[model samples]
Target: MLVSRGQQSTLLNRVKIEGRGLHTGAPVAVTVNPAPPDSGFVFSRTDLPGKPSLKACPERVSETSRSTTLEDANCRIGTVEHFLAAAAVAELDNLYIEVQGPEMPIMDGSSQPIFSELEKGGRKKQEAPRLWRKIEEPVFVREGFASLVVLPEERFRVTFVFIGPPPIGHQVVDRERDWEELLPARTFGWLEEARELREKGLARGGGEDCALIFSSGEAAPPYRLPDEPVSHKVLDLLGDLALYRPILGHFIAVRSGHSLNNKMARKLKEGEAGSNARKMFADN
Candidate 1:
């Protein structure tokens, strides 16, 4: 079980990473720096004028196609799940991300690269206590065959079920495994989808080096773990949920994608707002 920390934390040192965008194929550079307490995760577009910034929040999410994208009137950022996942697991309370392109660098197609950088930067505890959004009641959301539920729990946990075609058959991942085991699991796609994705102006930077390509009933191995794809689904789920405040709950997901995950995040944020309002009224 993942227990919540009592105090909030941020990076002790700044870290930088450079790579190509997974979808845009554009060269991108990111600098992760520590922010003041309660600053949360803020992404600033250095490539744009005035360096417009957007805080990582469910209401700011503009797109959930294949990946999560955050946008505001002045700037936009794409494919942020991997970075957010790393930050969440690291228990980082505040960070300022400076982006030099439209999307985040898709390093090794997993959260491992970002996680490693966070470790190198080290963690520093702040003065304020962590603002954890504890699940007092169950929250559920669904999209077609996909569904996600958050139940009251003492610690953070995720159980994911991935159902796909042929070589990428049925797979299930539960809380038995550690979060580190899921870090190296790369994103994946069918070999046939490559061309179509490129034609549609997506996955331009994707390749065997950055993602696992399944062909002829087999994934291009060696595998990072037993079921890498399912592990990645869990990673994505955690990242999407990070849009809300730190949570203490058991997340059960079934074939849920970014879209459904974002919907659940928005719901949680709304619930948190209502909760805070009630507490304030009672205190008054």
Candidate 2:
């Protein structure tokens, strides 16, 4: 896909979508409205009084379990990665997302739905040049068997590895495919984990329809694409990175999830700060 160059962008019109939340099981109505350039992606809780808003940034990430959640003083937005991933791929720089519930609708457990909506809504370029974080050095994080590594690159790219139990073993995907190629890859969970999550008041609205359920000894549902699970992980990483400015780097993630992904974002943010500081001192 051709990356949007030079100017920043936002939706040209307001787009609305309604569906059931993955965890809340309650219906939600979301309106994606255009905002002035440089505003970044922000969320507003319309169901609550005062309509509190929260910026979608790595610093505001409050939860990174099976999904990513953001929080402000008293407002929270859950399961936001899929939506943010779509926005990133669309090269959107500013948006005001108003939600009528605590979480976004599962929307087939992939980013394709969100991308389609944004495509129909259209995009408009702004006056300011789009900002980007270009990694000049390698940065990495490791925990147990998982790891995330960022290397300097001219464009954003990702390589992800997913390792699951039987019926789904180790899978590796290396590519710079466009969002359209990866957007339909659905979030997946082991059958046991899915049941436990539901018992803990999560994934209440999830079923075989929205998410892929894997079993220890049974077959996985027909895949939308080869290595769909790992592709979805790549999608999640893209969404997490979208929390900050677009990155010009290559990411290598192995057995990683949202927690590690968010940690990488924090590290990258710190790296940017440090780089700016060094440049300032050198100029003096």
Candidate 3:
């Protein structure tokens, strides 16, 4: 018989932040605390009567608009990928996130706050061996004008293509996981999207200070990479990985969003059934 030794870790302490939800425009506060072994990542809405905690998983997904919303029928939580991404890349296997609102704080329209808080909280190795979902076959899904596919790989890889009206023209990014370089890419919105979102009472407070707002016939702000949209798309994908599955495969995304992300996550769940590879994961 063969056995594999792997590393698993979680945070040593808790981290907290306060801000407003990007779309809901609701003021909220969040605290990420360490959990017992195998707790994974769970969200507790303290604002609700019972402080219902919604665990991050595909099963909890109730909607996928501009952001991902997870609900348990009794309660709902929104816009959580960035913080989840921070925990994923840091390799935290367990966390307890208690929020005092319906959605998480936008926190600079990026995962910056999550990153900073994770670093300050520090990471500690656990006694348990890492449990990973080793991919054996291709799993995929499609949305309007977009698609997502994941194929077997030794490590995580994200491939995305950004295309639309000019300046926001066709762009592609494919890279193996590098959390440090990828984590800082901020979320963005076009003028048409911004205005419409506001008209609909969403993200009315989102501005240049928080997100990268791109308008027609105008140049983009100082960017770290030529195709930063695709990079940020990768960030979004990583955040969604908090579904607590190690997708040992490459994900190819084209004009995708939370909808496609949730779709692909569901498909991946089905494929993992009866996989020959060693699968280690917590209940998400």
Per-residue lDDT of candidate 1, residues 125-148 (tens digit): 999888788786799999999999
Off by over 4 Å in 1: 1-5, 216-220, 276-284
Task: Return the candidate ranking by TM-score, descending.
Answer: 2, 1, 3
Q: Which lDDT values do the candidates have, in the order given?
A: 0.88, 0.88, 0.77
RMSD for each of the candidates:
2.7, 2.6, 3.9
TM-score per candidate, chains pooled: 0.93, 0.95, 0.91
On residues 46-128, what C-alpha lDDT tens digit does candidate 2 reach at each position?
A: 99999999989999999998899999888999999999999998989999999999998898999999899998999998998
lDDT per residue as tens, model 3, 33-60: 8887667788898888888886788778
Candidate 1 global Cα RMSD: 2.7
